[model samples]
Target: MSILMHVCTLVIKILVLPLQVAELLGLYQLYKRVFPVFIYNISFSYNSKMNDKKRELFRELLRFSPRAGPLRLLEVGCGSGANFQHYPSGCRITCTDPNPHFKEYLQKNMDKSDHLVYEKFVVAPGEDLRAVEDNSVDVVVCTLVLCSVSNAPKVIQEAKRVLRPGGAFFFLEHVVDEPSTWTYFFQHVFQPFMYYLGDGCEITRATWKHIEAAGFSDLKLLHFQAPLVFLIRPHISGYAVK
Candidate 1:
């Protein structure tokens, strides 16, 4: 058993060496930029199989009216622009991300989204979205973002602040699992290292609690387990109207 543990530790050290070197050389930014493509390819591929079910449940929330001329959307993290193809026609999206490296990936996704208008990309954090005005956008979309923000409440407030009165905040996030579960135990034990491995992602964030406290009306949410994404298995997804 001791020999097996030593082997596991050695493997971990070997795996982490590249990450340590990237941080030391200030190439972590470049890593963060290129990393999402691989992750999104996996995640989106899995989720695409369920897109028909999702559309049946939440298509109305994502769709906009062409009669209204144009609808504005504010995507908080917008990493690698994974959600661009999901937007309705005539929607103009302003994507914001702290990592400037995502600019290239986002632009490429924008080019593919022929239905949605590519507004612009802002290099900013979700916690401070001063670039957007109050109650201006029709929707605020946050996917797999709140768990990584330093202050989730502040980011939620910012999402609320920028949304028009009747507009909604749509989110898809991974959260900590329920207590006493084996997955929860592993998630808790490995949480600290998740920041480094997942680019500041918190495996145990009570994101649903923060969203509930944001004072949004007509709140609706769903909690489910995703066993595929090893580090981020517990997930919550839904929308809240402001």
Candidate 2:
């Protein structure tokens, strides 16, 4: 088993050698352009497979009524607007993503979901959301994002900053499993390959810890195992109130 795992890892690395070379040669623009297309294709199947679980979770977290008027939402790392269907009707959503290439796909999703109001898409990392005003949004949503960020804590802080007092930060992310688990062992083994193929996603991050330390007034986080690839099955989902 050990030898087989090593061989599989080697095979995966060999397949991604071109990506490694691109990075080494500073072909960042090419990487940025290609990654969104890669994720957009993969997300269709992934979303379909995780549809029930994700739909239920989104419904629960986004259930709250705003104090007044339509709910204002800011989603960090809003790749291809995957959560559009789950949002309540008349939601005013501002989408942000580091990759500009996703805007085209995002617009298509927005056009399909006419029930929700579409705000402009901003090209910004979650760690620095300077374009969004402080305390301006009713809810901040992040899904499958923390793992790829260079600094999870900074992203959470920015999320909290943009949310109105009493607004909520809703998050759903895959995290590292327990140390003794076989999944955890493999997560570490294939992490480098995943980091490249996934456009900086790190499977072994303990993302829940960053949220816990963000000083939310109230937090309700839970852990579960998603029916996904073994390396990314362990997951966390819930909300934190500012």
Candidate 3:
């Protein structure tokens, strides 16, 4: 197990080295902007697979959106439309993002898929989502997105406003691990560069605390981890029943 762990660590460092290098050079924004397109292109190649762990992280929330309520859903930061395939039956899935590229690119790519439910694609930021109507959506979903938003707290508040009573909010995010020494150290050391380059992501944030402040209760975390090697905080993904 120790040998395998070392091997995994080595592989991760090697793979992430380019990003680290780019981060050093202040080209992280360039990297972040293009990474989505690269992912879009690569996702089509069956050999370039979704890592099982990432799939598991997304699976729980994606699978839940279908059953949350009978109304509709609004997904904030629908990157590359990656979560589009998981919409529940008989539900309306409306997605929004500030990236204009994502607006057309995601639509063109995902439009061909035969869906089990109704879906709509829109271009808007979270704060302005009030145009969608109050208490109309059955659920608000955020996937790997809270980390990159300009105003995550405001977005969460808007999500609350748009959701109907007894509805649910689901999110899957990478967050800070308070318990791990290495995690805290790296986050402090690298967060400035990461923020500038990775679209305002905060490695030291209390994402769960923010969620609670967003007025969500009855929270249930399906999965979470805080081991060394820079925590991924997958437990950030869970349901907040309204």
Best by lDDT: 2
- lDDT ranking from best candidate downward: 2, 1, 3
lDDT, each prediction? 0.79, 0.88, 0.66
Cα lDDT tens digits, model 1, 163-236, are 98888898888898776576666666566557677788888887999999899988888887754566577888
Q: RMSD, each candidate, Å?
A: 4.2, 2.6, 7.2
How many collisions between residues are there in candidate 3? 2
Q: Rank the candidates by TM-score, best first.
A: 2, 1, 3
Clash count of each predicted structure: 0, 0, 2
Q: For residues 1-242, write the lDDT of model 2, one tens digit per residue.
A: 56766777787788878878888898856777887778778888878977887787778644555757898999999999888888988899999999989999898899999999998899999999999999999899999999999999999999999998988999989999998788977987788788987889999999999999999999989899988888899999889999
Please give each candidate's TM-score.
Answer: 0.83, 0.91, 0.70
Which pairs of residues collide in candidate 1? Answer: none
Among all candidates shown, the one with the greatest TM-score = 2
